[model samples]
Target: MTDPNKSLWTATARPAESDETSHETLHGTHRTDVVIIGAGFTGLTAALKLAEGGAKAIVLDSVEPGFGASGRNGGQVIPGLKYDPDQVDQMFGEASTDFIGRAADTVFELIDKYRIDCSPVRQGWIQPTIKQAHLPTLKRRLLQWQNRGCNAEWLDADRMQKLTGSPCFVGGWIDYRAGSLHPLNFVQGLARAATDAGVTISSQSEATSLQRNGDNWIVKTAAGAEIIASQAVIATNGYSGSLLPKLRATIVPANSFQIASEPLSESQLNEILPTRAVVSDTRRLANYFRISPDNRLMLGGRGTFSEPASLKDYGKMMADRRMLFPQFPDLKVDYAWSGRIAMNREHLPHIHQPMPGLTMALGFNGRGVAMGCSIGGAIGEHLLDSRVRLPLPFSEMKPLPLHAWHPFYATLAIWYYRLRDQLEN
Candidate 1:
């Protein structure tokens, strides 16, 4: 099996690449107080917070900022995680639960502080029911969340049909805590802010080697620059693999895809999603889609590693779009692409100390937006504060078994999911 070449997120939304790419190249060695790898959400957030806390940050990436999932996402700042609140509460202790709940409450806090304007639409999120089997479970989940002081509302079938413009959904709930954004623009804004704050950010430069040197940590880059900082952070997430030792085993790289449609006519757009709430269904392997600010239907779901050429499955995306929405089943196809996320075994964020002065953070399990920002900022404080207070959920860094069976096991599990999706109600 090979990595999926076809991904939808890559095709439609894009960052202002020329802005970051055309900058001068790195030729000589440089130094800074902090060096951040992988200019995605996590790295940029860390850089910004580090700079804010009176530390100089040097950020390096294999590509420009927002070149990865940070820019290519469907732009939904949906609240919470793939897991329900109760599940999250159970996974972590009560204090951890409170910490996570408070953490999510601060997503917009960073946005407001940084003045990020990626077309933020804090209009909340919904999970439309594609079948009846999940109605009860979803309803229970809704009440569970509501009981916890959450602003969640379970709509009746009539409301859901009217809101979704389709009778296919039996019913669904809306969590008012979430919203959407042009992720690329949001990430770009973060990068711009970090740069302005004196963070020395360099694109197209990769961290080639990392080692310990007594009281300092040394980082060598492909551009030949060596950074000796009092502390080091491995914020590369999934991409941190190989370049940073034991980084790959801490998480699983799940392949995710997305597709976007050409903007619909005004009438058709209103006919489809008038309220413009983001949506994902209850399927184990599910389809998550939302109407863009310009009225395009952006849909994402499915994992891929091969036959990637088929990811341009615009036809399939449209079929499902029409099947559920039906109003604009005929919407014109436009963009398609995919990317990878670091999914942890526990489906929670992980942070650990690879060495005394070094730290590792990864595995948002797909909640990169809020969790990434929270982790980045919090970990920045952790490093600056000498790791006195841990910021992430997992206390220890447990590497995924690097046995030869990993890829095989992952592929088998994905295949099993493909089969299970068919059998899932």
Candidate 2:
């Protein structure tokens, strides 16, 4: 049986050399060209890019790098935003959508360019339709990507079954450019690259407050250390805390839980997900899954609105996994864990400048793995040259209504979605 408490990635992943680096807690004043709060993919990528451009960067995180959603994610490198192309264009206009759409491809490019050893398998991503009613949206989604010159294709029920080795899906679509990777390894690799590129990373250095000093910002840490920088990037995402109350209020942090089964026998593996492509379903409370590099089946989905008190609390998720992959009827789960996803009302990643000399990017919905890195790169470019326009349209930060009741409402919303999915299917 899997350890109910440990994250599969943390328990099984080969430790990166970056993890061995001794990141002392911030204890004194420090200065850098840019201060990045949160050492997740976004901050690490931004640090790497800024260092490459000869800019000095100091990264501070409450915990170690990749300790948040960046490491705990399902590891699916899905391209594009949570919204469909038409919705994106409708919300942000054609020019911004086109620009952001192209930037979504940067994740794999970065992996290839940096030679990051994240065990990336670029076989594409499949979104299967769990209900006949889902076929129209799948077809429309395929057309949207096809119109953008993406190598996207729609698949009939037989093709979906053949590709996924399951009959649970009626039909689906595949995005040829999408793929999967060991997300923890990917983020750790970025940290190593950032360190090698001369960026200073300090862990266990939580930013407790932020204050402006003329053209610069002074970020105070819990350990009495402060980072003075002309520019700052708040990349905390779902972990955003009191350092910026308004920013935290802008996102509803929803918990996502995942479980991994013991490595399957070669015969069983071959009979399941033979294409080795990452897969997710069309339900609002969808399930995403894939075979890990070591042949373990990793299944994940929306869990409780708040963090579950224990792995036993993931009973629903575990049950859902078994239902989705009945071929593994005797599967032995090896790990279970959960993390928060920053959900925006618009169902899209948000880039905002709440104040001058400060930039904030969060709310990727559930598509953070690839989009976070892409947006981080854009932030780096913007920091280097204010004239550089980011693909994501910048907007003023607007806190959601009834932000204080987010946990209650988020739980209620999940229940509603689950009911809708059940009825639709």
Candidate 3:
């Protein structure tokens, strides 16, 4: 497997190497108001909120915090869900559109409150379309969001070409609520903030088992440590495994691969993505790309189901970048990495309560960064007060049929989508 630490973000982000020592392994029995498994964005954000509310919370991760998708994402903090505003209204009610539209606000708010230095750039996110047939959908999407008071703007072919410095897109839209950041730094900052607020986070401490004991839940760690708490949260998104077989069966972990080009020259940068806006496109398996703080062209898209083995695994991504910006100077691949995305059939973030005093949320599709923090904070609030409404509705867990053969099914699906995308062009 490719070392995740080899990624460009990890090499440049904050939370110095010495800071890893702060997350000690859990070795003793402890008591807290709540115990959370998987110290990624969701777990850390929830713990931070609970601690701020004067509740004792303990977070345990098999590896260190930010070792999962939280630190490995493309860092484009786009707001809203997979559906557009009108679809959100028809499916989840009108109120949901407003909340979902501003989901990125939570990310920026948290960054500002904690003073996280994650190279935040609110230049906006562009969704350009290479397929002309998709223009009507983009039009409706823009109109609906604008009607809801969102800062969404339409981009004609000329405007799109001017902004992206590419003539491939016929048209697109830009959502000003979106932005990019150093993902590793943002998650590490969350850890620091959560610890400052009195949340106990343990690294290399896996929750081996959980059993109900009277009114509390007893969680045993791999290192023979124990934690008894009144509430428990399963915040392990794409990394959730055999520890909870049923939960793992509810979603497919799709791998996303990314490659970073060598830092671009000032002239090259000006000729490509001159506005520095993060971009994605209108395709079944969309390609997302951004300009890194160090000026590297970071492009990403879906990958094989398994962990990547070498740079060749990202060959398609590198080719895509070159095709998008052929005017660039010599482009060299400096980094290649992959992260799993939790995808469910519904294509929405799902919250579930399978048992008493236990809450679980996962399946953010490709929008985990903003949704994870927003939904996590809401989960924390709901746990503190039942009357507090959640941004998403809780549904019963329905494990996908033939879950074990998901790899085969996902591969076939990817092939179909790839063919469809090609045919559309």
* lDDT leader: 3
lDDT, each prediction: 0.71, 0.86, 0.90
Model 2 whole-model lDDT (C-alpha atoms): 0.86
Residue-level lDDT of model 3, residues 43-123, one tens digit each, is: 999999899988999999999889999999999999988798888888878877777887888899999999998999998
Off by over 4 Å in 2: 18-20
> Candidate 1's residue-wise lDDT over 289-329, tens digit each?
78876667788766554424653544555567777766555
Which residue runs does candidate 1 get wrong by more than 4 Å?
1-25, 102-105, 310-316, 386-388, 402-408
Ranking by lDDT: 3, 2, 1
After TM-score superposition, what is the CA distance of residue 249 in candidate 3 from its true location, in Å?
0.4
Assess every candidate by TM-score. Answer: 0.88, 0.96, 0.97
lDDT of 2 by residue, 1-425 (tens): 55565787887676556445666677888989999999998898888889999999999999989888999999998887767889878887887667566654688788887788888988889999779987888898899889988987988989888888777888989887888888888888788788878999998889998899999999999878988999999999999988888999999988888988888898878777888899988789989989988888888899877566766787887788778777667687788888988998888788899788899999988898888998898899989988988877788799999999998888889889889998985
